[model samples]
Each structure stands twice: as C-alpha cells, then as structure tokens.
Target chain A: MQKSLLIDPGKCTGCLQCELACSYDNEGVFNPAKSRIKVFNFHDQGRFVPYTCTQCDEAWCLHACPVEAITVDRASGAKVVADDICVGCKVCTIACPFGTVNYNQSTGKVMKCDLCGGDPECAKACPTGAITYVDADWTGLERMRTWAAKTDAGQRATA
Target chain B: MKYVIAGAGPAGVIAAETLRKADPEGSVLMIGDEPEPPYARMAIPYLLAGDIGEKGTYLRKSKNHYKDLRIDYLQDRVKKVSAKQREIVLDGGGRRAFDALLIATGATPIKPRVPGLDLPGVHHCWTLADARAIAKRAKKGADVVLMGAGFIGCIILESLLSRGVTLTVVEMAERMVPRMMNDKAAAMLKRWCAAKGVAVKTGTKVTKIEKSGRGLTVHLDRGKPVAASLVVVAAGVKSNVGFLDGSGVKVKQGVVVDDRLQSSAPGIFAAGDVAEGPDFSGGWSVHAIQPTAADHGRIAALNMAGHPARYKGSLAMNVLDTAGLISASFGRWDGVKGGDFAEAADKAAYRYIRLAFDGDRLIGALALGLTDHVGVIRGLIQTGVALGDWKQKLMSDPHRVMDAYLARAYA
Candidate 1:
C-alpha cells in the first residue's frame, strides 16, 4: 500500500516549519515563496490550513497540459512536473482546482509537491505533529479510534 | 495519406501530434522556417529573464519526440500554396505535394518604416534568437527604451525589468493594452508600472531613431530625446498570410477559416495566429493567444483525421502579469452597446472588478489584483448562465461574483 500525508489542521500551530523545511529541501533556500507547501492563514477563523498538491487521481493539470509535462510517480502516487518539458504556459496553474500548482517565474516552469519522493520533509519538520505520513488506506483510523475510545465500556469499535 | 502542416509553432506542432494519434498510419510532415525545434513563442519572455534556457522554449522536450511518433519535420519556408495541385512551392525552388494542408505560419512583428531600425542594439522580442541578442546587452543598469504599450510590449517590459535594466516605455495610446483592457484598468496598470520605477510615457510615439555616442537616441513626439543602450520594438504583429497571395484562399486580416477551421479552399485549413476564425462577439477575428491556438490546432487536426468536431468560437480573453500585478480580460471586456454593466475599484489597494452583462447573462469581465473570482467570472461567461437575482446582487457588488456563481450555478 502507498503512504499518504495525513493532515490535522486542528493541531496546526502555524509555525510554518513545514514550509521552511520544504523550501530548503527542494530549492536550497529558506524562502517560503518557493515552498511547495503553503499554510493559508484564516485570521478571522483563527485557523491555518497547511495545503499542498493532493496528487489527485485524475489530475486536471496533467490533462490540461498541452505537452505532457506533468506525470505521475507510481511508487509515491505523486504527480510531478518535468521542467524540461514545461513551456511555461501557466495553463496548468489555472487547471489545478486547489491552485497548488504554481508558476515559478524564475525557472519558467510549474512547481508542485512531489511528496518528496515518498519521504515528505513537511511531515518530518512538523513540530506539532499536525502533519504525518501514514498508510493511504487508513488515514482516518486514528480519529476513528479516538472517537470510539470515548464511548461506553472503553471498547473501541472496529472501523 | 500525407498531411502537410506549415509553421512549426504551437499550433503546427500540436496539429502534427494530434494527427498521428487520430490516424496511426497517416504520414505527417511539418514544415518550419526556424532552425530550432518547434517552440512556444510565449516562453521567449522567460528566456529573456534567464528563467529557462533556449532548450526550455521547445514545445516538445525530447528531440526524438517527433521521430518516435514517425512525424517528419523539415526546416523550410512555404513560398506559395497551389490549392488546385494540392501542393506547396517552397523557398529556393523546392516543391512538395500534400493530400491535405494546414497553414499555421503564425505572425510576424510589424517593422516601422523608420531610419536606424536596422542598426545594432535594436531588436524585437519575438524569437529565441532575438532574446539571445537582447540578453547580450540588457545587463544590469543598462538604459533601455521600449516602443509600444500593446499586449506583447507589456509582456516584454516585465521580462526586461527582471533583467534589472533601466527602462522607459513609449506608447502611442493613452494607456496600456488599450485593445484588451478598459481605460480604468489601463490607468491602474500605468500607475502600478510607474510606482515600480518604470518610466511609462503613454500617448507618446517614437518618431525617429538615431545613433548617438556609445548608445542610441530615440526621438519621441512632443518630448525630449531618450538615450538608451538597447531598444526593444514591440509595435505589433501582422498575420503571416502574405504567402497566400494567389492561393485562391480568402484572406482578410488573416486566412479566414470556417467553423471546421477549413480555409476557403477545400482540404486546406489554417490555425494559430495566422487564422481569422469565428469569434464570440461576431464575424471573424483572431484571438492569437496560446490557448486559442491550441484549441484551433486540435480541432483542425481532428477534422483532418475524419473526426467530426465543431469549434464553438474563440473567446477574447487575455491574462497578463505586469511586474507582479495580475490583470485579466474576458470575452467582450469592452462591453457591447447598450449592455448593462457593473464595476467597483479600490485604487489604493489596486483591486478592481468590472462585469458586463447582456440582459443578466455575464458576457464579459475585467479584473486586476482580484484573483479567487477569476474562475467564477470565466465559468459564468463561458457557460452563459442566466443570473436571475444574482445580476442585481453583482451590480451592487461585483466582488461577490463567486457568491453569485456558487448560488446560481449550484442551486
């Protein structure tokens, strides 16, 4: 089974360590502007959502690309863009629903999270354990177990 | 069957690929005048900014991509098309026959009849070769004078700024991107550029170019002469339809194509900037943008391969990033006569949104520094959804386009 990056937005403290780690690991810089993962601040709601490419199954960015610049890494199930092939059309940036894919004006290519080739730097750098890498099949098991633990005789329900 | 495509830009390259997939056994021959591989003209700006190398401009990455598809690529210019003979006459007296033909010769920049245009240190930001020539002189702190404030000119300006050059822009129009943007939006752009230390001279024209000491003196109408080490000419581009003089193909501003992308001549089609196809507004017009070219190319190729596909029409849309400020124009952004409209702007924050309507139908939109609602405007205009109560709601506040779109589209 493939692994998935499970995110708990509630546990996120908005330290932006994931962003710093992501930028340094990939671009060799500490600039959050170049980081693939972004933490959107919702000031009124007092919440921060750590967001990146979901590596969607039927990726619109891959399909909308005039040239097959974006492809899937079967091992990690991460959608990756080939800088050599991208013509910097910026069409993929618009096609991505979550707007995770963005144009790198410096490189003239689109960039997105590639799951760090299965060992995500964001997950390791997350100080609050807000982000974690787990089996893709059971990303909700922890939450389900916690809810079950609160009910009745303390016997957890099999979910 | 042989498929002959002229022009090796985005439309031609894509047409060849689609032809191969549509007809696995069909032989594809694509002709281009450039020595390099098929490349996108849009990437030239990035190339000038040093973001990507020359090879990055290529539409297809692998050199063997066409070879692997069994598509034949040739470097030559089509001098004339003999529709009756179903063949084309090439430069240097070469001839080739085709079962069907596609014209994607794209466009060429209009060279003004001014002296010293052929001088050194003057270039047009169109081809990769031109970008190379520009990179040689557009160094940090180098004084540069750019002509024109049209769409292409603004794009080149952004890239030139990235090179850290001292820049001055001269435009004949009163504002930037006059053809695509409204006066208000254009004013915002002009102010934004000026705030970024760009010397924007709208309503100014370049009268003459003279060689000066160690640089060039660009004479402007009603202004002092501007001195610069480099001059970039982005006046405009004209369709590459001059070769079709006696081809019996109907030509206006470009090679006029029908709904199927077929030219006046049977078995001959035109795509990309060279094609004046159906427009959403009315009659025939050329969008000339990358998205339109890709769409037209695919439709033309599918029809060539015996697939019956109908193209609705090309919509007039332009999205521009002028030195960190994003601006977009959709559909009839200028607004149709007697069309109902709504607009709101915050000049201090540089945020603006104007919506046009033809009886509650979202027909057009213009926006600057207002993202997040771009998709909603596009969806509403493209789908032609009737905005019953939302029309009045939007008129009250155009920024609530997403609210209107979600409420009406989903409900």
Candidate 2:
C-alpha cells in the first residue's frame, strides 16, 4: 500500500516538533529554518498549519531541472534530488507551483521533501497527529466515514 | 507499568519526580527536546540581565539525581505515539511501547508575521536560543527597540537596563500590563519607567519594521521611526499544540484537559502551557503559570498511575522587576462596576495602593513600589477573609488594617 501524509490543522498548536525532527534528520541540527516541514501560524485566527511538498507525480521541479538532477524514488514515490550531480541552479525553485522547493545558501543546492525514504520523520514526530502517514489510497477515507455515519439511515428505513 | 515522558520542561520533569515518589517500581524515560534540563521560565529574564548565567536557570535536582531516581534520560523529541498500540515512535526509527504517555510540550513564542521579522537582530525571548540571539545582537551602547510592553517585555527591559542598553518600549495599550494592574497602578509604573531613563511609548503601534544600516527601524503610528540595533519582540506565546491535530484529541486555545489533566483521548494527558485545565478562582478559566503547571503535572501523574487526583486551580500572580522597580499583582483587580474603591498614593516615593471591594468582601487589590503592606493584602486576597470592623480603619490606614487581618488570620 502506498503511504500518504495526513495533516490536521485544528490540532496543531504550532510547536515546531516536526520542523525540529525534519532538520535533525537531514541537517544534523535542530533548526526550523532548514526543516522540510514548516508550521505557519495565522495569529489572528489562532491557527497553525504545517505545510510541505506533496510529492507530485508529474513534478515541476523534475522538468525544470536543467542538469537532470531530480529523480523519482520508486520505493517511496518521492521526488529525490541528487545533490552531487545537480548544479546550484535555482530554476526548479521558481518552476514549482507550490514553491516548496527552496534554495539552500549554505549548501548551494535546492532542497525539497524526499519523504525521508518512505518513513517521513515529520509524520513520526508530530505529537498531536496533525501529521500522519496513512495508506495513500485511503487519504479521504476518514472524512468519508464521518459523513457516512451522519446519513439518515433511520429515515430511509421508515420510508 | 513504566512511563515515558516527552519534553524535559517544567511539566515533564516535575511529573517524572512526582511519579517516582508515587510509584517506585515504575521507571521513567524522559526525553528532552532541548539539550538542557528543566529550568525556571521566570529566571530567563534574570539570565538576560546578566544577574545569572545559563547555569543559574537550571531547575533540575542534578545530573546525579536523575540517575538516583532510575530515569533513563534522552535529549531527543518523541517522533510519534500510537494510542491503540501504546507505543511511542522515536526520531531514530525506533519505537517504545509504554503503559502511559505524558505530553508536556510547553509553548513557543509567537513570532509576528510583520515583514523583516526574519532579518538579522530581530529576536524573541522564548527559548535559550532566542535569549542567546538577543544577547549576541545586544551591544554595550546599542539602542534596543522592544515591541509589546507586557510582563515579558517589561522584564526584558529590567534585564537590558542593567547592561546600560538604551531602550524604547512600544506598547499598543495605553498602560503597561493592562490585564494585570489597574489604571492607578499602571500610572505609577509608567512614572517609574520614566524616572529610570527608559523611553516608554504607550498607545504606540508598530506598523512597519525595516532594516536600517546595521540596525532595525521601528515605524510607529504616533511618532518618528525609532532606530535600534536589537529588537526583542516579546509579543507572547501560544501552546505547542500543533502536533496533536488529527490525533482525536480536543484542543481549544490549548489542549482541552479535565481536572485530572487527561485529554479527550484515553491514556494521553497534557500539562503545562499546552494543557488548559480548570481554573477554580474564575468561571472555568485556564491558569498559565509555573506553579500551576507543576501542580498539573502532579495531578496528571497520579491519575495516569490509576491513583485519582483533582487539580484545585491556580492563582494568576505575577511579580515583575522592571529597571529595579518591583510590581506584583494577584487575583482579579477589576471590581464590579460602581464598586467601592479605597486608594492611597505617595507620588514622591512612586508608591500607590488601591483596594477594590464589593461591599464588605475584598475582590481585588493593587499595590505598587515598596508597599510593606503587600504581604497582608495578598493573604487577604488568597484566603477570602472578611474585612469586618477593620473596613473603616482600612480606608484611613491600610497598613494598620492589613496588620489586623494578618493578626486575625494568624490567630
């Protein structure tokens, strides 16, 4: 089964645990600036939304890469960027519609979510289950079940 | 039934120790997101002031103490928790199934979305990293523009003033600590700030912030741009509840916990800044303080171990030391509309005291400066003692009246 990442904004208190986990795994530092997952806080509305690259199938960054450095990992279905092969050209950062791909000044390379080789750290680190790894095919199953449970089965039975 | 607690903050560490005493056989596995052990949140301002070092803020017993208690401490964050499986997923792709779980994640400072907030020298005072950033940016003679004149901002002012750093306090409210103090008490504090050479711009709003040649320029609503080398935005903090989304836990402002600190989810409890429990003083309010957080940890641990306990609420008390001026307030200061008020002021000494009463019962009291009678007033507010015949004497000489109350309570 293809695993997908699920995010619930309501349970998010903007703790940045996922950010810390992501940065620690990738960069060996607990820096939010370098995290693959970012928690954005809408202060007035009192909401925190953790956003990341959705790992698009028809990736824009893949097509935009002039050096053919971006490749697809079959095992995880993640768009993995080869740092050694790729030149520090920022075209992929601009080409992405969601702007998830970012240029790292320190490494002189572009970085995006690689799903941590199928076991995403952000999903694992999220204490509130704001971020979760579930079956990709059943991403909308939970919401569907909720709406299905609310159906007027009794009324239909009476009719 | 060993327990694993994530986050070695005030709530986490306190629960670990409390649990050790309650259940000797139950070993504790503590994971700290930060490298440092538990430290007092109130002492961070003192550390910034150079009155204390980073070591001075440490609140844990000692390195040997954790070993003695048989706790396996790991300085790492918990990656995930499976409530059904009762297992905690670690960041290193490891899992530890537990009998119970406690999440005392605490809070993080709210960084405003204003432009140039991420620029160099723009800092916050929530964490050790933030404090270090501010300290690194601060110079001996640099001007510091502090946004928000709340409790944290004012405490930072006290810290910065000791270092001889020029300060410009920008507050949106007309008075400082509007929620904590009355108008009269705020006025006294304002005067004290002025006397100490701190430029307080109350009712001032910062609309724009920009980098201006090795410093930041704060453009306010009412005045010209104030240039400063460092900007410490002590706006406030929100509970670190973001990770609990989709976890089947109820969250509102904070993690919705019962009097036992248990969330809607079974076996998962939240405490400290992240958990909002019952506030007994008011109508089901949430108390956010170090003592309350500690209390929540104790109560939660007992219940987590199948030993029932209930949290009896917390006092909303705050003592602030700003540029050597001491201000402490407790309980509700705003009396019912048109309630009787007894006030006395000594402008020369920068001292003022006001007792708001709703007929014989004392509702709130505000005392500023070196008011030696504060101890007595605080006791009256805490114990809910009737003024009785001393009501008339309180209007004339509050010190004598407070003494009588103290004498009565002691008797």
Candidate 3:
C-alpha cells in the first residue's frame, strides 16, 4: 500500500525539530528557513502548524509546471521537482494554493517536500508524533477510531 | 482524434500532454517557430540573470520527453489558418489538417519604432537568443538603457541588476508597473527602485536610438540622451494573431473564445496570450499571465478530449518581485465603479495595501512588501466571500487581512 505523511497539528509543540531534520536531509543544513517543511507559528493562537506538500493526486504544481520539470515519483507518489530542469520561473510556487512550494533564491530552483524519496525526515523527527508516515488509505483511520470510540461511550452510557 | 497545437509554450505543451493522456492512440502534433525545445519565455529573465543555462529554460527536462510520449513536435511557424478546411498552413510552406486546433501561438514582443534598433547590442529580451545577446554585452559596469517599466520590464530588473550593469529604466508612463498597480503603489515602487540605485526615468519616452562609437545613444523625449552599450526593449507584447487573418475566428485584441475555450469556428480553441477569453470581472480579456495560460490549456484540452469542461474565466493577477520588494495585484485591482475601496500604506516600512470591494464582496487587491499570506487576498477575491463587518475592520486596518481571511474562509 502507498504511504502518506499524516499530520495532526494539535499534537505539534512548535519545537521545529521537523524543520531542522528536513533541512539537514535535503539541504545538508539545519536552517529552518531553507527547510521544505515550514512550521508556521501562530503567535496569537499559541499554536504551531507544520505544513508541507500534501502530494495531491492531481497536484497543481505538476499541472502548472511549464517545462514538465515536476513529475510524480512512482515509488513515493510524491511530486518531485527535477532541479536540473527547473528554470526557476517560480510559477509552481504561485500555482500551489497551499504555498508549500517555494523558490530557493541561491539555487534559482523551486523546492518542495519530496517525502525524502520515501522516508520523510519531518515525520521521523517529530518528537510529538504529530507527523507520521502511514498507509495512504488509512490516513483517516485514527480520526474515525476516535469518533467511533466516542459514539461507543455514548451508546454504553445510554444503555 | 487528430490534435494540432500551435506554439510550443506553456499552453501548447500542457494541452499536448493532456491530449496524449486522454487519448493514448490519438495523433498529436505541436508546432513552434523557435528552433530550441519548448521553453518558458518567462524564464528568459532568469537566463539573463545567469541563474540557469539554456537547457534549464526547456519546458521538459528529458530531451526525448515528447518523443517518449508519442507527441510529435514540428519546428515551424503557423502562417495561416484555414478554418473551413480545418487546416493550418505553416510558414515553411505546408498545410496540416486537424480534427481539433489550439491557437496557443502566444505573443510577439512589441519593439518601439526607434532607429538603430537593428544595430548590434540592441535587442529584445524575449527569447533565448535575445538573452544570450544581452548577456554578451550586458557586462559589469556596462550602461544598459531598459525601455519600458511595465510588468515584463520590472521582471527583468533584478536580472540586469545582478549582471552588475549600470541600468537606466525608462517608462513612458508616470510610474512603474502602470498596468498592474495603482498610482500610489507605482510611485512607491519607483522610490524603492531609486533607493536601489536604479536610474528610473518616468514620464519619459525613447524617441530615437543612434549608433555611437563602440556603444549606442538613446534619445528620450525629455532627459539628455543616455549613452548605452545595450538598449533592451521591454515595451510589452501583442498577440501573435497576424496569421489568423481571414480565418473566420472572432478576433478582438485576441482570438475571442467561449466558456469552452472554443473560438468562433468550431473544433478550434484558443488559449494563452493569444486568446481573449472570459475574465473574472465579467468580461472577455487577454490575461497573459502564466497561471491563466496553464488553466486555459487544461480547460481547452479537456474540451478537446470531449470532456465538455467549462472555464470559470481567468483572473487577472500578477505577483512581481522588483529587486527585493515583492508586490502583488489580483483581479480588478484598480477598483470598480460604485465600489468601496480601502487602503493602507507605510512608506517608511515599504508596505502598502489596497482592497477594492463591491458591496460586501472583495473584488480586487494590491499589496507591496506585505508578503505574509498575501495569497489570502487572492483567496478572498476569488471566493468573493461576504466580508460583512470584517470589511470595515480591513478598511481600518489592512494588516488584519490574514485574521479576516481565516475568520471568513474557515468560519
């Protein structure tokens, strides 16, 4: 079965370990600014939401790519940007509604989450288990289970 | 089904790919005048900046991507369209019949009628060859006079600046990016560029260009003639619809298309800068932006594949990074008649915002230096959400746009 990165923002601690690990794995640095996965800190809400490419089945970046630089990796089901082919027009960055894809000024190429070719570093480094690589089909499994357990409790209390 | 796609730009490339996927056995042919592989014209600026090589400008990375996909590519320009016969005559003296035709012929650069434009060192930065020629002469400390400060002109600003050339941007308009932004925002952009040491000559026009010793002299309407090693014309582009003459296709500023992206002539569709498709603001317009081109390609291809898709109309949007100052405009940014307009500007901080609204619905937006969640403005405009009381909050304090967006979009 294909796997996907499941993220539960409620469990996030805003520690940025995911960001650090991501940057290290992809860029060989610990710079959060350079990380593909960004932890957006909502200072007013006191919440941190780690966000990256969702690897959409019909990705806007893939469709918007003029040069056909963005392609779906068969093994990972991830939209991977071929750095050599990317002309750095930043069209993909604009095309992404989630704004996950970003332009790297130094390299003049757009960068996004590649899911680490299979094992995502962000999911691996999440201390709070906020991010996990799970079965793509079962992404909603835990949420359904939680709702089912609540319903079971309601039924038991009524009985 | 046989599909013929004219112009190998973004629109044509995407349509060809989409057609291939929809009909694996269908015959598809893409024709382009440029000798090189399908390349993004927008990336030519980056090419001038020395960021990417010529290969990087190509639309597809692999050399044999089209061949692998069985999509035939022809290196020839479309000279005439015989709509009745459903055939296009190429400039190289050949006619090809097609079941469906896509006029994605894009646009041609508008070079101002200035003498000595034919001289060496003078070029239009529209193609790869142009970029190479510009790069050769646009050396460090080289005097480069860029004629026009519109969207394309502003885009190429950083590239020329990065080349370490002494640049002078001449715009006939009163301010920079006149078409994209309002007066206030344009004035701010001019100031910002001036601070960056760019000689911005606004409200000026280039009258004549004369050959000088080892350089060229540009005569303007007002200021002293600027001596330059290179004169790069970024005067903007016109639709490449010259070949569509007597084609029976409805032609306005561009090929007029219906919601299905079908032209006046059935079995023929148009996309990209060459098509005067529907606009979000309830009119037909040529939105030459890249996103529109991509969207048009997909929708047009879907219809070509007999999927019967309807285009939701193209939104006029532009996000420009002038040197470092990021400015974005969306939809009908220059307010509508009987519309409520709100704006906030911080000249010192290099920040600005202008929101246009019709009743409670946000229609357009413009921002400079306020990069954080600027997409929210686009979202608000696109969704046409009822801002309600939050509209007043935005008018009072535009910085709360993110908060307003979340409150409205999520709520």
Which structure among the candidates has the greatest lDDT? 3
RMSD of 2: 25.6
Model 2: residues >4 Å from true position, as ranges? A1-159, B79-82, B90-93, B337-339, B371-378
Q: Candidate 1: global Cα-lDDT?
A: 0.81
What root-mean-square deviation over C-alphas does model 1 reach?
Answer: 9.1
lDDT of 3 by residue, B227-246 (tens): 99999999999998988989
Candidate 2, residues B1-411, lDDT tens digits: the string is 869887777678768877897789997888877767666566677677775577656654255778888878887777766777888777767788788788888887887777778878888887777788878877688899899888788878887887788888988899998877877778788888989888999998887789887778888889799998888898877888776666677889888887678888888888777887776456455555655566677677787777777665555555565676666565566777776777788888877766777666566666666422243444455446667766776777654533445333422
Q: List the residue pairs that clash in candidate 2.
A: A11-B245, A12-B242, A13-B241, A13-B242, A124-B79, A125-B79, A128-B243, A128-B244
Retained true contacts (fraction), each candidate: 0.05, 0.00, 0.19
- The order by descending TM-score is 3, 1, 2
Top candidate by DockQ: 3
**Per-model CA lDDT versus the true structure:** 0.81, 0.71, 0.83
At residue B379, candidate 2 shows an lDDT of 43
Q: Where does candidate 1 clash, by residue pair?
A: none
Cα deviation in Å at residue B158, candidate 2? 0.7
Question: After aligning candidate 2 to the native by TM-score, how far in Å is the CA of A62 from where it should be?
Answer: 61
Worst 10 residues of 1 chain B by lDDT: B370-379
Which residue runs does candidate 3 get wrong by more than 4 Å? A10-50, A104-108, A127-129, A140-159, B370-373, B387-393, B400-407
Docking quality (DockQ) for each candidate: 0.07, 0.01, 0.16
